[model samples]
Target: MSTYVIGDIQGCRDALLRLLERCRFDPAADRLICAGDLVARGPDSLGTLRFVHGLGTAATAVLGNHDLHLLALAQGFGRARDGLDTVVAADDAETLLEWLSTRPLALHHAATDTLIVHAGVAPQWTVAQTLALAGEAQAVFADRERRRAFLPRMYGDAPARWRDDLTGDDRLRCIVNVLTRARYCSAQGDFEFAEKGSPGAQAGDLMPWFEVPERRSAGTRIVFGHWSTLGRIHWPQANVWGLDTGCVWGGALSALRLEDLHLLEVPCAG
Candidate 1:
């Protein structure tokens, strides 16, 4: 049985199917792990969601920022952007919303020491600490009443530092931002969502979360997908793999075989 970690699908179901076929994926025998952004910006959001959802126990996904945005819009917490034109506006949006809400912000595989998160981690957190913090934030979203109130407050940059005293929505927002939207962060661990371009294009003061010297997950193989601009980056010492190759922007869809570290990529149809 093989486990494959795929890059951001971004609703390019055909490209995803081709990559899976090239890998000879058997749903019954193989497991698939998606780095997230399973929908939006491409041709088939609904089909992509259905395909992944159909995988059932064979699949695991970390919630991407796009996925969270879809959830928020479905729940009426925010408006959809013009770029999100491909998302399904159907009655089943509620079902999609529920499934997306249940996804965890991060996943850890003890056997392989592989940690999968949507974006980057807070420089201050160890892998274990990040997992624990993710659980706390996930619990709030899991509860119906709390999630309704929490979604509105989910859109900010308050409580910049991790403080034990931060209560209510402030704390949850920080956790959500770190797990979902993070890319570059200040030395003090403050996230800057505005820097979406390639890593070198950013100001010298900002650093990629994984570049931090004391990153606790340095020993583990960390797989993430949000920064398509980074394309595929391999840090030998860090054991970090970035698979986002900008398929939504007509680039390539990529996947890595976890057991052997083999790469499989397919071009987008446009």
Candidate 2:
């Protein structure tokens, strides 16, 4: 059975199907992992959710920033019209949201020695620490009462540096931002949440999260999306594969066949 890691679907069901076809994916014998941002900025958010969710145990998804936004919207937290209304208004909205909410922020594939996250990790964190901290934050998101209380307080870019002494909302927020929205970050473990650009475009000491010198997680293979401009099939230094090709932005939807590191993509109408 082959495992395929796909980039952000962002509601592009047709693109996703075509890409899957290109990979010759068979739900009965293949596994799928989504790099997240499963909804928003594209058509058919509801349809895409059903398609992936219908895959059942054959598919796994991490929570992306947009995915979290959909959860917050479900709790009557925000009023942003970011193309997710179809999902919120669906009859199965609650069920779909429940499934999405409980997914991990970071997952490790022991067979591949690959770490899967929506975005990237804090430079100071090792593979074990990334998973542990992700679990700490995941606990809050997976529980109903804690999620209701934390959703509104979740929109922040504070305390970029990860400290062991950090606690409460601050600690969870740091973990979420790093896992779901981080890109350029300092070697000191500080993140530039505001900068959404390609590597050469960012200024100052900020570098791509994986490129940070002596990044503890650097030794393990990391599969991530969220940086569409980074494009398909490129490993930052050698151990990471960035698959987002901006399917929601009129680019191709890409996926990596993890067993052999083969890349496949399908152009999207956007």
Best by lDDT: 2
Candidate 2 ranges with C-alpha deviation above 4 Å:
236-238
| Superposed Cα RMSD, model 2 | 1.2
Cα lDDT of candidate 2 equals 0.90
lDDT of each: 0.81, 0.90
Question: Which digits, one per residue and each the tens of the lDDT, describe model 1 over residues 1-270?
Answer: 998999899889899899999999999999999998998787887788878888888987888878877776766778776345345476676666677778888899766778889888887788898898889877877777878888877887776666657777887888888887788877777777888888788986887888877776677788889898884567666688888999989889989888888988999872
lDDT of 2 at 225: 91
Clashing pairs in 1: none
Q: Per-residue lDDT of 1-270 in model 2, one digit per residue for the tens?
A: 999999999999989998888899999999999998999988878889999999999998989999999999999998867678778889999999999999999999888899999999888899999999999988999999999999999998998888989999999999999999999888787898999977888989888888888988888999999998873357757488888888889988989888888888899962
- Superposed on all Cα atoms, the candidates' RMSDs to the truth, in angstroms, are 1.9, 1.2
Write down the TM-score for model 2: 0.97
